[model samples]
Target: MIRIATPDDVPVIHTLIRELAEYEKALEEARATPEQLHEALFGENPAAYAHIAQDDATGEPVGFSVWFLNFSTWRGVHGIYLEDLYVRPSARGGGHGRALLTELARICVDRGYQRLEWSVLNWNRPAIGFYESLGARPQDEWTVYRLTDEALESLGKRG
Candidate 1:
């Protein structure tokens, strides 16, 4: 069963975030705190939303997806930018990941959004195959860039 996440699920969500980070070999870099999650998801203003997938019989959450809306200037419409989608290591092949993505697609269709997109690590072959099987194509022509920490702060100071 897939359902929207609530504030009460912050702790579990944080755990999942850590688990995902560990799997991606970035556990030491995972800095999401429960307080930050609570404020981001349930405070006066929300920056993102999440959906949780639970085992129907055990009622235990098996996976989750965090996402937010982003604008595509060329498309001139908003699209769903999935930030993280993770299934517990023990829960692979249970369809939780697919179900979470399917529901997100449904939301896009229902809301008339132009697209649903996310990034995967270049080394994750299994994930790349999974996404390809789902008819997702990589944007080879486009390069992704980011500025963080000192660079991000310095840029802000420049303005």
Candidate 2:
């Protein structure tokens, strides 16, 4: 079963985040605290929303997907930007990931979202294939950009 995550699930979500980071060989970058998650998901102004999938019989969480709303200037409609999707290795192949994606897609369709977007690591071939199997195409024309804390600080001092 998949449902919106609650405050009590923060710890499990954090654990899964770490596990996913480890799988992606980026564990060093996974340093989210429960407080951070709490504020991001449930604070007065939320930054994102999370959905967790649980075992129907055991009630143990098996996977989760986090997303946030984005506005597309071209489409002039709100869309969903999937930030993360993680399924425990042991719990994979149980259709958890597919189910989660289907649920998110349903939300987009129901709400008239013009697009749903996410980025996959170039080396993650399995994920790329899986997304392709779902009829998702890579947007080759665009490149993603980010500014880290040090970069932001430097920009502030550049004046």
Candidate 3:
């Protein structure tokens, strides 16, 4: 079963996020605290939303997805930017990942959104194959960039 996450699920969600980071060999960069997650997901003006996937029989959460809406100026419509989608190592291969993605697609279709997108590490061949099997194509022509930490601070001060 899958359902929208509530404030109470923030801790579990954080745990799952850390687990994902570990799997990606970037656990050192996982700095999201539970409080931060709660505010980001449940604050008055939420910055993101999350969904939890549970075992139907056990009723225990086995995976989670964190996402937010992004505007496509060219398309003139909103799209979902999936920040993280993680299924517990033990619970993987149970269709939880696909189920979560299917739900996101359903949300996009229901809201008349332009697209649903996310990034996957190039080294994660298994994940890449899974996404490809789902008919998701990589945007090879576009390069992604980021500004954070000292660079972000420098830019803010320069402005």
> Candidate 3: where is the Cα deviation over 4 Å?
none
| Model 1 misplaced regions, further than 4 Å | none
**C-alpha positional error of residue 71 in candidate 1 after TM-score superposition, expressed in Å:** 1.2
Q: Write the per-residue lDDT of candidate 1 for residues 1-159, one digit (tens) a residue.
A: 999999999999999999999999999889989999998888899999999999988999989999999988988888999999999978878999899999999998998889899999999998899889899999888888999889999999995
Whole-model Cα lDDT per candidate? Answer: 0.93, 0.92, 0.95
lDDT, ranked from best to worst? 3, 1, 2
Cα lDDT of model 2 by residue, 116-156, tens digit: 89999999898898899999999999999998789989998
Superposed by TM-score, candidate 1 places the C-alpha of residue 115 at a distance from the truth, in angstroms, of: 0.9
Report residue 139 deviation for candidate 3 (angstroms). 0.3
Question: 1-159 in candidate 3: lDDT tens per residue?
Answer: 899999999989989999999999999999989999999999989999999999878989999999999999999999999999999988889999999999999999999998899999989999999999999999999889999899999999994
Each prediction's TM-score versus the true structure: 0.96, 0.96, 0.97
lDDT-best of 2 and 3: 3
Poorly placed runs, candidate 2 (over 4 Å):
none
Best-performing candidate as measured by lDDT: 3
Tell me how candidate 3 scores on lDDT: 0.95
